[model samples]
Target: MQDEKGILIVLSGPAGVGKGTVCNALREKNTGIEYSVSATTREPRAGEKDGVNYFFKTKLEFEKMIEDNRLLEWAKYVNNYYGTPIDPVLDTVNNGKDIILEIEVQGAKKVKERYPEGIFIFLMPPSLSELRTRITERGTETQDLINERMTVAQEELEMMEYYDYVVENDQVEYAVDRIRSIVTAEHCKRERLVEKYKQIVEVE
Candidate 1:
């Protein structure tokens, strides 16, 4: 296996499907992949450190970055700027450290455009009703917002065909194991190791 260039894993799903939970669990279970940190223009909350928790920037700075095409994927949410820094992502992955991106469906699509070779995995809820319940249990949104999220989730599920794999987030441990297997399988693909073996053949 070529250890110089690593894999880019894009993990995405609709809201309330527990994509974050599964990603966190997977990170703990395996230390092989690095988590991509996002940059934001929002003010840092207590206990948050710059360049560690998030690369906090001023709104002006962020806009300048956008003007320079420095960000890989970015979106303005409720007047705050949030985006993935392009250089760090490419640098880390290209240096042989697998990086995982936990983003929404829309952002995942953008990453796919820029990096089509990435391993895109979609996390799905068991059912819509269960999805609604999960959203409600979070207590993060009102019933009306929950309804909106359910609608979005339904629409997002239809786009699953674009993904390389779909893992149901029914049981946390099971989902983590399934993702680990996917990573292992991806690394074993013939295409990924083809050139490495060719070099060995030529050397022999």
Candidate 2:
């Protein structure tokens, strides 16, 4: 049978919801899913390489990409541009390789508008109190910033209704298992394999 096109998995959630941790653990399991690297106009830090860590670009270059509609989803933050380049994602999936995009809720929404067929998974925290604790433990934000994040998180949580699946990130391993099961179930979906199977039947 012919291989089906891989699914685009969009994992997103509120700040401090452990989206990054869950993605890292999932990838470490050798699940055969590629991490989608985004392009950015921000200066690359030490040991970061182009096309590997990110597709580093100049402000002008990044603007051109936005104008050309070459990005699946783009966002501006602190005067820097960050976006997922559309070509790489299409290339990876068309080659029958699953790719996971760990992005913000807003960016994920933009991606959905363009690629509605993508598998959008929302990583949910156990509770708002736990989410606040997680952000506090990060130690990278001020009290005021933490408060702001909590507010934003509440809004993001409300957006979970837009996602296809919601995986609770109470434990990293458990979340990864749920995601893996979702991927397996998506692959086995009859609509995804029907055409290939029909070809096999015709051949027989």
Candidate 3:
């Protein structure tokens, strides 16, 4: 137990792909998983907390962090700085609790570069048309903003080659089950458990 290292599970998808919903559902089903909270310079959305949802920072503060190379992966997203802090993710995984991150395409790429061994997952919507509908139904953005998101999403879908797995988020429950199964499978990998078996063999 003490020597077991945690797993890093990254979930990324286009806008309106139900990534947040699917991640939340998986967290509810599996209590051992930890969600990686990202830092952002944007104003907090409705019901979004500062530390829990995102570590809200001022532009200057965030830029200073960028200068210091404190972020694991950061980019100018929608005119704001959003990035993952390096400390929390490493600490959690070392503590033996699996960590999951829900990020966009560019951020996902950054995570892949920083943590190449991390488990990368891409969540896809049923279709691009349906993706448009879902974004429209939100009613929080103007048509122009929605269009921009859709454009970015289309580009993101084309970059799925970098991911270890792609889970279609057509149904929340189904997506949750698939992610859960992935964790179970990862645990069964021979390399992950070899250290424990080696110690036992030497003892007897």
Considering every candidate listed, which one attains the maximal TM-score?
A: 3
Clashing pairs in 1: none
**What are the per-residue Cα lDDT tens digits for candidate 2 across 1-204?**
678999999999987999878988987899999999988898886677898868899999999999999999988753578799888899999999999998888889999999998999999999999999999997877898898888888888899999999999999999999999999999999998999999999999
- The deviation in Å at residue 171 for candidate 3 is 0.9
Instruction: List per-prediction Cα lDDT, in the order shown.
Output: 0.85, 0.90, 0.87
Q: Following a full C-alpha superposition, what root-mean-square deviation does model 2 have from the true structure?
A: 2.3
Report the number of clashing residue pairs per model: 0, 0, 0
lDDT of 2 at 48: 77
lDDT of 3: 0.87
Clashing pairs in 3: none
**lDDT for 41 (candidate 2):** 90
How close is every model to the real structure, measured as TM-score?
0.86, 0.89, 0.95
lDDT tens digits, residue span 53-137, model 3: 8999999999998999888888886688888888999999888789998888898898898888788999999999999999999
The segments of candidate 3 whose C-alpha lies over 4 angstroms from its true place after superposition are none
**Candidate 2 lDDT score relative to the true structure:** 0.90
| Candidate 1 Cα errors over 4 Å, as ranges | 1-4, 40-62, 76-82
Better of 1 and 2 by TM-score: 2
The 10-residue segment with the lowest total lDDT in model 2: 74-83
